[model samples]
Target: MAKAFASQGDLTEKEISFTEIGEGLYAFTAEGDPNSGVIIGDDSVMIVEAQATPRLARKVIDCVRSVTDKPISHVVLTHYHAVRVLGASAFGASQVVMSEKARSMVVERGQEDWDSEFDRFPRLFQGHEEIPGLTWPTTTFEGRMSIYLGNRRVDLMQPGRAHTAGDIVVYVPDQNVMFTGDIVEYHSACYCGDGHFHDWPRTLEAIRRFDLDAIAPGRGDALVGRDMVNAALDLTGDFIRSTYRPAARVALRGGSLKDAWDAVRAECDPKFSDYAIYEHCLPFNVARAYDEARDIDTPRIWTAQRDKDMWEALQG
Candidate 1:
């Protein structure tokens, strides 16, 4: 019998946690589901990584309303993933920001990604019809952009490509808190369907240079305190290496994609099988790793058709 398609079978709603990890900083995490980071300034609020849809994002908005009356003035897109950006309209932010590379990705494949992801994870896109359309950024920066909310400073930087070609991190120097999108997940599978495996470690290294007191990752729980933050970062780096290395080795040896998948499972299952979305991500992650290992520089676009074919080929 064929396995359930992607996350189509995952319909259970997770318990949400809205926690303040630092001064006026909040993380909206749902028990291993996608997360969003909230940064409250003196006058306004800045949200990092919008939820999957406007209806789903409203829950996050409700959480924000519970804390402050400040209007959301900035919506930051860490990358151009549907689960992260399609909810931009819910924020009503004056400025929607993302890296130039990320913006380009949205222009190139935003619609395809939207369609592909909705089919892959129906549960995440519960209010799919409510999504106005493709999410476009009002501002696009190259390397770094500094945003000042009254006196509080928030720095947005694209360290390097990891989760996507334009993955960005939100850093608050004053609080020493960072919001790393899918670049570094905590106890959650890093979706590598559009990742840069060879460059992910380098990107992770760049993030390590910061003295982080806390980190709000793309998924899983928020990490507070320096020790826990460091551990989370280290674990994320380890996960990236472990997932890609074996598949990469197999690919380099001219093995079949199945061989690469088998290699990855042998190496990762023992340690990461219990992680959220581990099973859902393995096929896609292995496919990307195999491509990167064989020196495929740019990640191939994942259309709905491609997602189905890849799943059946590997997990069927």
Candidate 2:
């Protein structure tokens, strides 16, 4: 490859912030790295989105320890991305939960996603030796499931396919706060390599209808009010549309992948260049958007070699 992916050069450590969004709801964010959500129930706690490795997961555990001594009994994965689910062992939760489709993806492409992610961003996988193996959900649900942390109710529902075919959001009705996984991002580039560009907006509407008071987004700071929450949603929607529109146009015109990349950059760079992981995500986003525009519904799995091939080709 002529050069490494932008994330390959992102070795600098990010400062972690644990912010409370509601009475017992918190968001654990690390700059633009994947964010984790903490929900304190009447008895135990529920975690959303485990980090990449056990070592990274410990950072979230540490934050939990600082706030409450309640044991983490449930770990709800929002999707099947390796960065979000491979650290379940660290939580030692009694139940690790995921949507049925997500569990299937883990079985189908879990290893490939892990390898491709390691190639792209090594910092997130600091404790590669401690990963044990692919993380699997002990509990799986079809569309929706409600788990009670004593009196507190946590609803895990698959709103629609957006970030992935099995993306789910953890909603706390009592607090009016939702832990949206990669379905929503703030100021950070959405990794569309395994995303549904067309369905994402509709899924966002499903979430917006909840009129959440706050949101713990996938990769940015905790949104604590309606204005901030709306801003994050708007930014996420704009980013997706800007990237896909130009790429779709290129694909419709029967242009090359490189041409699609160029068109997407011309449209997105001006608005999203400063967002975290922007450069790293652009090529993959364009590739998927072009594929979707070409009428491919299911996203093709990404492998380490495929990552390099796509990166190298776009370097032209």
Clashing pairs in 1: none
Best by lDDT: 2
Shift in Å, residue 305, candidate 1: 0.4
- What C-alpha lDDT do the candidate models reach, one value each? 0.92, 0.93
Score every model by TM-score: 0.99, 0.98
**For residues 1-316, what per-residue lDDT tens digits would candidate 2 score against the true structure?**
4556748889999999999999899999999999999999989999999999999999999999999999999999999999998888999999999999999999899999999999898998887899999998899999899999999999999999998999999999999999999999999999999999999999998999999999999998899899999999999999999989999999999999999999999999999999999999999999999999999999999999999889988973
Q: What's the residue-level lDDT of 134 in candidate 1?
A: 92
* Residue 17, model 2, lDDT: 96
In candidate 1, stretches whose alpha carbon ends up further than 4 angstroms from where it belongs are: none
State model 2's lDDT: 0.93
Residue 4 of model 1, lDDT score: 91
